[model samples]
Target: MPFVLYLLGLAVFAQGMSEFMLSGLIPDIARDLQVSVPAAGALTSAFAVGMVVGAPLMALLSRRWSRRTALLFFLTVFLLVHVAGALTTSYPLLLVTRVVAALANAGFLAVALSTAAALAPPGAKGRAASVLVGGITLACVAGVPGGALLGQLWGWRSAFWAVALLSVPALFAILARVPAGAGDASGTGVRAELRALRAPRAVLTLLLGALVNGATFCAFTYLAPLVTEVAGLGEGWVPGVLALFGAGAFLGSAAGGRLADRGPVGPLLAAGAVLSAGWVLFAVAAPHPVALPVLAFVQGVLSFAVGSALISRVLYEATGAPNLAGASATAAFNVGAALGPWLGGIAIAASLGYRSPPAVSAVLSALALVVAVAAARVGRPGAVVVEPTR
Candidate 1:
């Protein structure tokens, strides 16, 4: 494997940390800005919105540019936004900065996925995708908590500063490691990319990715409450439980990468079924202290295993549009990220318990399984046979 792949992972780590760290910093931000907590929380939503919209847009705009240029531009934008966000006292300005940072993050992620796949050896693209996804799982394990600690010790602004500083190394790495002309598009315009997306197998694959991600986030977004309220654990236990889940995700990504190397369909079908069952089991055993944590870890493993494979599968299905495939996958996952929490929140608003989120997740996972089956059938006979390239 090329060292540049790992550098892309490092860049992803910084972006993923920025995406998730706000959950722990919202209260502090609200107090400092003299805004309501919910208003401060909107910053997170703003970022999500940017990510959902920016991935494809940025990818299209930069499709002709070299991967190195696109990455450098995005990272520089991300770093500057964090610096601006940290210095801004006005809440609206901070919100704007968050949106801008997320846009940059989305662009970088979209480009990085293609770049990784292009850099990997034939039949090893799955492992390359896993390397990138591993950065996100590792961020969940270390970066988010570390950001919270920084917020606790120095203030939320310091966390922003830290994210800015973190991107510096990745910026330098991209300059030194990534080949100058790598990931330059082959002149397949936006029309060609859109046509590729219209393919049945590609559509189904993207839907599967979205459904699996939705299911995962539906449960994950509410996990802290589930642990405290249903499992009867204290606040202190939350971090440990979350860390356990992150550890599971990291392991799952590695395993899923290997599984995907042979074929994505079978592993997705098997994992999706087990993941749905696991969610149901989790909901049923939510009140059991021992069972709850164990189930959370298991669910994490299954969910991310499906997720990592889906990332590889999407690129494979959309091979006709190499430059846009990564962005499409990013959009699909972010769409799920937005929708899953809303669905889970609806369940809670109706007075359903914290366990209800996992139940909701189960339904989403089952839907994903159905989509995966459909994708497999569609891909069996006349699959596209384009190689990934920069």
Candidate 2:
């Protein structure tokens, strides 16, 4: 992998830390803002909603520009908004900042993924994607837990300030390292890209990506409560457990990359099946202290392994409009991000207990498995299977 790939990964790490750090801050945000926990959880969905809206809009706006240019612009907006979020006194203002930050993040991630793919040597797309996605996984391992501890010590707003400070270096790195004119549109125009995305096969592939991500977030968004409430752990233990989850996710991304390099379908099927079973075990055994860490790690591994495969699948399916494929995948992932937490919040509000989410996640994972199987069937006997560029 080129040094630029790591720079892009660093950019992703900075952006993603702000996004995923919210899971740890929710309890504090709820307490400080005088809102219900469910209300605080909605902040996660708001960020996702912004991503859902921002990705395609950024894609359209940046169609004529190089990805490095788009990325710099997006990171600029992200940096400014994190400062705004840190300073805001009102929840509504904070929410607005979160949304805007997500818009910027969406643009950054969409372009970054495309840029990474373009930068890779032939047959290395999966590894390149992993290096990029590894940013988020690494954010989990370091950034989120660090943010959680920072918030715990100084306050939730301090975490936002920390993220803002981190972004400055990332922005400089992007300016210095990411090559100019990387990831410009290959051959497709806006109309042609839209047409290719509208194909039934492409749409289905994107839906599967959304489903897979949604299933993961359904339980993940509520994991904090599950840890402190169900498992009866101290508040101090939350970050440690989250770190364990991140460690598992990191391993999963590496293994999934190797599998996806060969092809994502097999890994997708295998991960999906394991995820379904894992969620069931998670829901059943999460309350037991002895089982909590083990279950959390297993779930994280399966969830992120599927994520890598899904991204590869989306890229493979969008071969006709490769530039738009990363944006489409970003949109799909955020759509699930918004949906899962919103649905999980509903379940929590209804008094279904913290365990309810894993049950919901189990159903969603099963659906993803069904989609994966269907995709395999669809590719059989005379059907074209578009494997990622190797």
Candidate 3:
């Protein structure tokens, strides 16, 4: 179990590193590719779109396979495509690679979570899911900074190559540790997986993922700008701002997981409250760097807190349709990722202050909280989550 979990973490680390490496490298990419910074940013968008397109397709394709086999295939594409992203020189090709690589990454992550759950001991599935997702938490804790440094010192391509290199070792680890013939996480047949999607509970879980992610993106997409233009800080401070943000993210994620184990709804409520309050703070602090850190820390914690709960909720609800539920969650996150940045960008372009994005984000979080509460009110024994402590 430890070996497989470690491999899953490695895979997630690679994915997280790949997704965020571009954050610090966008300027370099623009300069080298002879495009505007906004254009360079398109690569990030393309990766997200690919996740949307690829998630469901891959999930469907792997219906007949065990979660292990499905994951292995997904990572094969995941590793190679990232290497392709590193090798490409043409801007268009780079965009294509980003899309393909991220699609594979999306599918791979869903499967990793499923596989981890399958491997868990009885009555500790939440811990298992947390272990799978810990990679992203770790990425926030360390991978982003490390990737950014590589991008800063070597080049953006080198950063991608570093991510690709990490994959080689992870792939080898997966091949060595994971046993064959593992069952699906939910023990549902392929046909049952399809049927589970029709369940209202599954649908609600997906909506929660989308709404929460949308709020997360809205507040965070403009973080750099919020800390700079709004606070009148120089670019030199960007690294520190991001680092602090990541630290907050790490703390929040760890705490949230424990909270979810105690009561699923508890963590969700706290996170949504933090999101709303954090955004309000952003609105007030846009002009003050000192205030930004306080908000940023809370922002990071709240932003990342939902994922474990959401993924677990969907998986638990999907019952007969675990794969589909997993894939749907990925799609929902992509939707949020897309919606968040586009809205934030538009707000920025319209001469709205940086606070505008988080303000908008606050509204979305409020909506998510409302939906979560509604789900609780409906209170179907299995439909509304209470999540007892371990």
Candidate 4:
């Protein structure tokens, strides 16, 4: 509930914008760089790959640093990368920038989540985590669109310039607002973190987090095709439907925070259940014009609702090393991000139809629910209970 949480959220918003804005800039980048569209698309893939590798590596490297310092270090690197991206003319240089930016982004996010939990009131880590992650959802709603518009009005480089500029306010806020020594982990070395990673319950929770993300992205990555080809909606309607999903995400994050603060298990189980049913319903309703938007919104809501609880659960189980736990969750989530789309693409390639993605998503969601149930049974005999202090 501290104001510093909001400040950290601002930093996250900048990173989120950088991650997604590339989608809207692909054509512009290709034209400007005189590269193939697929080559330009590789930039996005590079960022994602960097995240999966950077999360754990940064946590390991920064195990002895305070969270605030880690955040500042990464954010500064991120800002510089964007500046280089904005100025660079060489296609290879741009690609390198993207990868380095993603590394900084991954480090910042892992530290930020753990820092948010560390700074919150004893019982409100879930709520605090939500507020931190909510910035990413808000970026989906606001930052991406704004970046796209800016790129259209100016150029693709304009978006990078804007993102770099945005980091300034976030830097100032972090320096001025976040107290020193707030997320100190001086004595907690890589050995302690490695030991934490060896715990069975901690590993399960990390995988559960990954599965939860896999379930969401399975359908989401192919949403455009689902809306236009399957639902029979015009291309113009795509933005509106996506906007509805973003709005739902914003609201869902706030609601999830409250629910997660109470306990992690209920929110995890409920979110999984609703998401499973929603994806199944989406598969059936893919052809209905009215139903597509409704289902998209519901999917967005349920997909993100488990985020706070998942982070909180991991932090709890890895009491010896919160940063590593957060980094593991980040890596797991990105793994799911990469895995879900591949699985959905396989289904589509097999002539399973556009509706196949949601069907795949449903199965994944059901599997995630099973994982959540098992995760809930990890620490306690009766039900999952998150004590105030791990």
Ranking by TM-score: 2, 3, 1, 4
> In model 4, what are the clashing residue pairs, if there are any?
none
Summarize candidate 3's per-residue lDDT along 198-249 as a digit string, tens digits. Answer: 7877777677777777777666556655666778886556566667767776
lDDT (Cα, tens digit) per residue for candidate 4, span 133-155 = 68877876777656656766788
**Which pairs clash (backbone N, Cα, C closer than 3 Å) in model 2?**
123-390
Model 1, residue 282: displacement in angstroms? 2.4
Per-prediction TM-score: 0.88, 0.95, 0.89, 0.84
Candidate 1 total steric clashes:
1
Write one digit per residue (lDDT tens) for candidate 2, span 15-111.
7789888888899999999998899989999999999999888877887887778989999999999999998889999899999999999988888
Query: How high is the CA lDDT of each candidate model?
Result: 0.79, 0.82, 0.70, 0.75
* Model 3 quality (TM-score): 0.89
The segments of candidate 1 whose C-alpha lies over 4 angstroms from its true place after superposition are 23-45, 87-94, 152-156, 374-390
lDDT of 1 by residue, 1-390 (tens): 788889899989899888767655665787899986446646766787788899999998788788999999999999999999989999989989988988898899999988877878877887888998889888767776677667767888998998899999999999998898875667777788889988876776677778888888777767766877889987556666767777788888888676666643444577789999999998999899899878878887888887777766677777788888889878877777766766776787778877898999999989877765665566541121223443
At residue 168, candidate 4 shows an lDDT of 94
**Which ranges in model 3 have alpha carbons more than 4 Å from their true place?**
66-68, 183-191, 264-267, 378-384
Clashes (backbone N, CA, C under 3 Å), per candidate, total 1, 1, 1, 0
Model 1 TM-score? 0.88
The better-scoring model by TM-score among 1 and 4 is 1
lDDT of 2 at 308: 66
- The worst-scoring run of ten residues by lDDT in candidate 4 lies at 380-389
